[model samples]
Target: MEFRILGPVQVYDECTGVLIVPSGAKQRALLGALVVKAGQVVPAERLVDELWGQCPPTNAANALQAHVARLRRLLPCGEPGSGRPHHEWLVTRPLGYALRLGDADTDAGRFRRLAAHGRELARDDPGAAAGVLRQALALWQGPALQGSGQGTICAAEAALLEENRLVALETLYDASLLAGHCHEVTGELEELVVAHPLRERFYELLMTALHRCGRQAEALGTYDRARRRLAHDLGIEPGPALRSRMESVLRRQDPAGAAEGAARAVAGPATGTGPVDEARTADDAVAGAVSVRMLGEELARLRGHVDRLTREHRELAGRLDRLTSSPVAGPRDLAS
Candidate 1:
């Protein structure tokens, strides 16, 4: 059995290969609220509030009980004819009701775990991180609880989940850049920036990608756009991370520096991961910093070499053009 709320509130039955989702909007809202905080008892009062807002009927509690009963019946159980009850997944607690689920039973839970694992692997192995992050992103079908109608609880949960999805996507783009696939991800990053103009991280990723592809001018232009948008919409400057990136691009520093920073940003000092792990994490950050500095130096040298070659090519072209235009000197000189 898998409970999925990443897109819509749904239950997939492995035994029967059927999807059990509540049909009524309010019922879906109630289910979404409970599933978002699965394993915790959602008080009947809270459910009533989510279903009817402040205008709940006098019999809201009774109405909620009816909805829960229907939802329980709708959940799929064991083998078709086994007469098993699906109510095992939903437990009645003294505080309220709780939805029981294993650690990996929910798509949202699995997505978080996968994303965490991907972030952990990013500093050491970018290719593997990209692959894992891809898997994590694949879990999102659409906006979380898309059809579920508005309730503050439901809306807030949806927003939080979507934000997580975007962060994971940005991390994936970072991994792709570190794996030397900036050209391939530029289009996706562009779309993300358009979709989320207020998101500084996406803009930062886009700028880094553009810079890596030798479009430093466009990359700098992206920073200008980000700055203008942030100032206009939020009446604020870009955050420290984004401002730092803009400075790096302006200085024509290593594009790989952005990737290292991304690694630290996503994987930084997660609480409860312990002292030994913290020390290891610090070591990794240092290693990533060193790698960024070395790569920046190499990129600077290469850019200089390319610039020289381009200048020489243009000078040679100018001389050739002058000689060619100089009055068919070939015939006159040959005759002499």
Candidate 2:
């Protein structure tokens, strides 16, 4: 049986799938409240505020009674079996209700315990860390209640659980990297960074993994992206750790620091020569092709022009020759 808080307060019984939350906002709120304080007491007044916030409806205690009655029907397996006809996981308290989880079970609780163990194993035996974290992660079939907990108080609880989930993921990634499984961390890290642009740790892990994989340029680019995102979204640079990591990367010092640095210098100004080289190679394949086309057109025009000019020059030369070769003819011509 699983009582989820990350989305909505859900009851998942292995034998009975999902249990329905009784109708009415107060009733639903009771289930959520019970899940939050699972295995602990939730005072009636606290349930009132959690359900109605600052302005609870009249007869709030009575309303709480209705919720409990409904939830009681859905008692999880292993709940305390009293000698009396009624079994009580939620016993009548002097002030409020107590959800007895020993009588119940929750995936959330199991997941958290597993995550704790995984974190403990992260620095020592990463394989064991991966195994534990994976088990913890596997407990989440989907977002709690498929995003059912969007209410004011419910959302808060959901967000808290989600944060823990991400933390577990971070530890998981660390373990994977230590186990020399850097390649496997990319997909998860990419999603995490996108989902949480302000989280510098995710960026750090991403940068480091990229560096370790010999993708130094990509690593630095990732850092630049983090800087830009933080500046754009939060009007601040990446926190100290990320900024420090970036500096080390640019200087090619301590490339293997706490966070990975690709150890590559920042990209320099490009001269557009990559395209130029490609164009030059392609044009060389058809050497002088363009010049030949132009020359062909110019040659036709020049040849015709030159022939006409040459014909006129020959005519003038013939007249000059007559005067020089025939002396008398030349004198008579001059007289005429």
C-alpha lDDT score of every prediction, in listed order: 0.80, 0.69
**Candidate 2 residues 1-336, lDDT tens each?**
556654445676655465654455556677776776777777888877777777778898987787788778766534346322333567778988987765456777888899999998888899899999999998876565344334454566667778888899888888888898888888778898898888899998888787677665577778879877876888665677986665444444222331221111123214544543444443443334433553464466558768989999998888778777884675567564
The number of the candidate with the highest TM-score is: 1
What is candidate 2's TM-score against the reference? Answer: 0.66
lDDT of 2: 0.69
Off-target runs (Cα >4 Å) in candidate 2 are 15-25, 76-86, 142-156, 251-336
lDDT for each residue of candidate 1 in 1-336, tens digit (9 for 90 to 100): 787888878888776677887898987987888788788988888888888987998888788888888887786544456565434667788778877775328888899999999999888999999999999999988889877778877899899888889889988999999999999999999999999999999999999899889776678678779877986898666788986776676565433444545565566646766555555555455545644674575467558868989999999888777777777768554454
Span of 10 residues, lowest total lDDT, candidate 2: 257-266
TM-score of each: 0.71, 0.66
Q: Who wins the lDDT comparison?
A: 1
Clashing pairs in 1: none
